[model samples]
Target: MSSRDTMLARIRTALANGPAPQPPQPDWAAPVHLPLPDAELAVTFAASFRRIGGEFFYCETLAQLGAELRAWLAERLPDDQQFYVWEPTLQALLAEAGVPFQATEAEFKAQAAIGLTSCEALVARTGSIVVAPATASGRRLSIYPDQHVVLARPSQVVAEIGDALRAVQSRYGTELPSMMSLTTGPSRTADIEKTLVLGAHGPRRLTLFLLEDDA
Candidate 1:
């Protein structure tokens, strides 16, 4: 027999005689939990967000949120420009206010200047907003538009990324979303000549409206 064939036959005999190799067991540990007080979390998150050039606003109720949104739209955007929104209640409110918006993915990508969507969780530790594609806020809505407006309730804020992930796991159980995005602020890059530039890849502006629970 050829040397190559002899080597192959010896390997096959060894394999037949030896026991099968077992896969290694993972030494998995539970995630660490580091909880922060709510008041502290709000303050830290606001400071961090602003440091990264993100705008933050607080609203006590849905009515206040609507009013603030209307005022913001009137001041920042042209009346003729349409925004993208997926939340049904917010869409209704905008419609009532005569603000233009596109709900479909194609229309939003094609014509919308601003994208408004609800976030899955707000990470207070890093002042990041976590969004899942499986949720109302799809991948395109958060990244396509020039501006991004996020609506988040106070209860949705968590201490850190781990906490936010745990919240997702707890809510969804075994069936989790396919993808999750953690956006810290407006897209920026300092790679070009060490000078900071905004809107490097995604939205140039990020505005977060934090809804506070009624007392």
Candidate 2:
């Protein structure tokens, strides 16, 4: 045989003399898990999230969430700049906190500075915020804004991505949303010149507000 043909024949001979059976993948049906309290999960999630350049706030109650959120906005956003929110509960909270926001689609493109949304879960392992179509107010609110703030309850905190998936499944039954996004920190890209760039396709800042009391 020629050199190429000899090489091919050798490869075929090796394959024919290979191991009898292939190794099986680990069983995912029984995933490794331990029951964790929300307090512990919150601490782990906060550290993981902060490591990725995300801002985190823990509130003991919804009233605390409102006050802290209002203060946070006042410190960062100017009076003239627009803040947008679509979730009805969040809207009510903002109003009660005396925080100004535009809910309707009035000059959204020109005025969307910060967008606040509710989340599906807070994943502790990856410090990720899970946002699904069913949980979000609108797709644009999460992706189009300069700053994105996610409001989550302590009950929604999960230890891992799989846990988050299971929670979503339980929440929605068989009819799942079209997409579920795991947002870890801000949107970033290193494609252009191998230099890290933040907010390449989405919000520059990702802030998480975890309400520890009363979902």
Candidate 3:
């Protein structure tokens, strides 16, 4: 009918048989790690996580993992609490484990203050999460959510920070993504009166799951 309407129709027709549009790229780095003593890597990862702004828990198998997650969530979130889940594998696992979850990219930014997921490795040198935000959804889920749960396999645990950085440069190339967050722990600040506060701008509870297979 109108010029605008005609243009819209033409565009739709042009793209009707074309591939779907790809989502915008989100900011993400490979995966980062925190430094801990060789003998105390496990305990340090669990306790000092909050110090660096993270939370920690453990699980040997997927079933155990589910139980631990449920317990941690039950303690923090209320009965009516609604959370967003990222990763298809994670979603499937949750479903298989009978864990109630909602998978919505939009919801990730709506009610989530932090996102919980696993990483390729944890640099014992620098506490960081190597995120790959090639799409906006990955970035949104981690940052938007208030509390983030990270699952780190023992094998992925590195010894130094340089190794982590090098890993990123290699994984994504020299040109880093738009966003690469190196989260050592929960977000905190002591600028005001030098008094530390958790969840100041990010997740207050930073939980970690250092999974060990041989150990």
Candidate 4:
């Protein structure tokens, strides 16, 4: 037989065997989720967050947060690094706290050493911080800067990823943001020679300000 006919006969034999068996479908109804805890979600979150090389600081009140923020800035700045805050609420808080931040957009674009922003919700199970375009920070404040400081309240802490999504729904209803991101920790990669490197893609240092309920 000709090579062409031989190939065609092989294809017909394969087709006569019927279609291939399909792989099993994943269970999409309800995926495995961590149980909501009766213990303090903040504590659970802090532990999980810190385990991945993130810095966690619990502040009892707004005043304490302001003071600690000031102290942190004082220690970190003065090295000719530019600090800026853009979000309206964050700007107001920084102003009220007497914390210095560059408001000029040009300077921020030129060299933004540190960026301060707030988050939507803090995930306790995976130590993930949920963020969306709903906030004034948008995406740049959390991604572009080398150092990111997240100022979050106790009420924003949730037990799981699903809980965070539910909180977002309750806050925004059907008009949800275009995107949602769960930041478990500072950006890191072990792709090169299996040598771990932090800040390879984004912020090298991630500091969280977990404010108390009253704050």
Point out where model 1 deviates above 4 Å.
1-35, 92-100
lDDT of 2 by residue, 1-215 (tens): 79999999988998999866778888887757665666699888899999999999988876787788888998877666788889898888778767778888788888888999998888898899989877537688999989998888777888999899999999999999989888999999999889999999999999988876553
Judged by lDDT relative to the true structure, which candidate is superior, 1 or 3? 1
Point out where model 3 deviates above 4 Å: 1-53, 106-110, 135-137, 212-215
Collision count for each candidate, in order: 0, 0, 35, 0
lDDT of each: 0.82, 0.86, 0.65, 0.85
TM-score, each model? 0.75, 0.81, 0.68, 0.81
What shift in Å separates residue 186 of candidate 2 from its native position after superposition? 0.2
Error of 2 at 74 (Å): 1.6
Off by over 4 Å in 4: 1-34
Worst 10 residues of 2 by lDDT: 30-39
- TM-score of model number 4: 0.81
Rank candidates, TM-score, best first.
4, 2, 1, 3
Per-residue error at 127 for model 1, in Å?
0.7
Tens digit per residue, CA lDDT, model 4, 1-215: 99999999999998999988999998888658747674678889999999988899998877888899889988776577777777888788778877788765666666887888888899989899998877777788888888889988888988888889999989999999999888989999999999999999889989998877765
Candidate 1, 1-215: lDDT as tens digits: 99999999999999998987889886567445556777788777888888888999987766677788878987877555667888786677567646566776665545768889887898888889998887666687888888999877788887888889999999889999898888999999999899999999999999998877551
Residue 61 shift from truth in candidate 2, angstroms? 2.7
- The model with the greater lDDT, 1 or 4, is 4
